[model samples]
Target: MGEENLLPNKQIVLKNYLQGCPKETDFELRTTKVSTEIPHGSKGVLLKNLYLACDPYICHLMRPRGLSILSSHGFIVPGSVVRGYGVAKVIKSGYEELKEGEYVWGITSWEDFSWNFYPQQLLIKINITHDVPLSYYAGILGMSGLAAYVGWNEICCPKQGEIVYVSSGAGGVGHLVGQFAKMMGCYVVGSASTNQKVDLLKTELGFDDAFNYKQGDLRSKLNKYFPKGIDIYFDNVGGEMLDEVMLKMNINGRIAASGMISQYNLKEPQGIHNLFSLIEKRLSVRGFMVLDYKEKYPEYAEWAVKKLQEKKLVYVEDVITGLENVVSAFVGIYHGLNIGKRIVVVAEE
Candidate 1:
């Protein structure tokens, strides 16, 4: 290919391993040239990235390589593009299954263009047979949605009339969990850090009740909302909240341990003092990685799409339009600035 055909690819790279809470200064943006053509004999796909999702786990992966198993996965190498889930269009492909011009969602670098060598495992061809927004693939119809689905429907095995509580309930996964519980006829209550998010949960997301964790006493809030005790707890924020929720859990209740956003940036994670409650109340607390349930994506995607079409499910997104502002958008999530799924629009389809 000629130099004229090359495009300027912008990338956001990690400057160093994170220590405490992440800031925009932790990342650097640079540009490189890339071709739109796939080289001969290559088995990879060249992608035009459209949307990128800012997830809490990305902070964990930013730790030094040996600090944890997740960081050791080669996800964050200093001076290289940060890798995360995104929606992209195939510009050139060597795989027969993925055609040029098709859209996909999966693991891709934080760049305007990315080259994926393992499309079979890392990428799923997006089936846009409905009028669903493509940005939804970056969140609700993608990993976030899948995480909520597996954690609630499979892990919790919720039943109608169950009283459920979701921490960070207006977040990427938490909001969906609340909606799913409501769909099952369960009484759902959620906790966020802001009154706006609390209002979003009760008014927009259909939660039975919602509270701001930053408000008065957490235990008192729990008592007022769940006087009967919580049957299911979808925990997204760990720390003192988890400790308090355990004390009010119903017997034989289930707890889905999702992301611990509160502890991800801490030098030492906060300890939970309620393990005895698990044994005493016979509660089931399970920690799950969404990738383990990859096979269920199709099933979950179908259900979400149907609900979205029927207006039975609502998805909210905090969208930043340019990749240049991605760092600010990402850092905002930790401080509870985002009301829903935080995503950056790299390019418009």
Candidate 2:
């Protein structure tokens, strides 16, 4: 290929449908190429990826079809490039809405370059006027942030003096949910699997209280800390945590169902033992995907930026450099190794 015609691309590909927890061997790095220019009259743009998100949903989608974890289109067929969310810089474009040098974030691949055919619909341009980092667009300002906003504003609106609890409290979405609960003047508590993440929730993210779920006497600890009972539960890690939370929910409590990282890879998912409590407490549980709440993005983006400027919002991320670390980083999320959002830096902004 001529120097002006194309560029080399490095892509992460799935060799087969994933089973159990994803391993480094489940994926392979392959080299390809992307066109340096969109064909004449085509509404396409070429992009160089900056940041990529490692979310549990991606892990769920990699499973065998019957075991696929999704309520919508989110699966990865074997032999295709693994799809992910990322921030990218435009290199060439024929789309009126996209221009060279502008940044965008949305559905991207775990690759160095992307030939985006629907940039106008699939991409949102980064605000040149804002001081927010490009990486945040893949997380705190992207689907994860929007999800937290919806979980609080639409799903579970906590009131002053009410008790709020979050499972997976230090994850990409859970940490933000806990913080948003605090912003609403509620008493917030979070449950993480490690003491390091527990400390992060209590100190860095401003949760009123936090605990390690893997520790001794979980029921006793939840009782001692949330003596009055939990009013709202933002669920991220499901399975046994949800069971315990259900048993401790106060009357009229709400549960914002996000994901079940603990149950994603299981051949057989665990069942909650306390369904009777839902009826007895008259509780409300709402589950939603990011796209289900797209109407709130503008409002959330504006509110989040204002909070960031006023020093009221804290955005935490465990950013790893290089695509080589993507597998370990993604697998680490299930092992509770990240303190906040897990991002892979495929390239510099």
Q: Which candidate number has the best TM-score? A: 1
| TM-score to native of every candidate shown | 0.97, 0.96
Spell out the clash pairs found in candidate 1.
none
| Residue-by-residue lDDT tens digits, candidate 1, 1-349 | 6898799999999998787999888999999988877777878999999999998888767877424434223558678788888899999899889999999999888889999988987899998799999999999999999999999988998999999999999999999999999999999999999898999998999999999888899889889888999999999988999999999999999989987888888888899988999989999999998888889999999999999999999999989999998888888999998988999999999
Candidate 1: where is the Cα deviation over 4 Å?
Answer: 66-73
Counted clashes in each candidate structure = 0, 0
Give the CA lDDT, 0 to 100, for residue 275 in model 1.
91
Which stretches of candidate 2 lie above 4 Å from their native place? 1-3, 66-74
Q: The CA-based lDDT of model 1 is what?
A: 0.90
| Clash pairs detected, candidate 2 | none
> When superposed on Cα atoms, how far off is each prediction in RMSD?
1.5, 1.7
Question: Could you tell me the lDDT of residue 274 within candidate 2?
Answer: 89
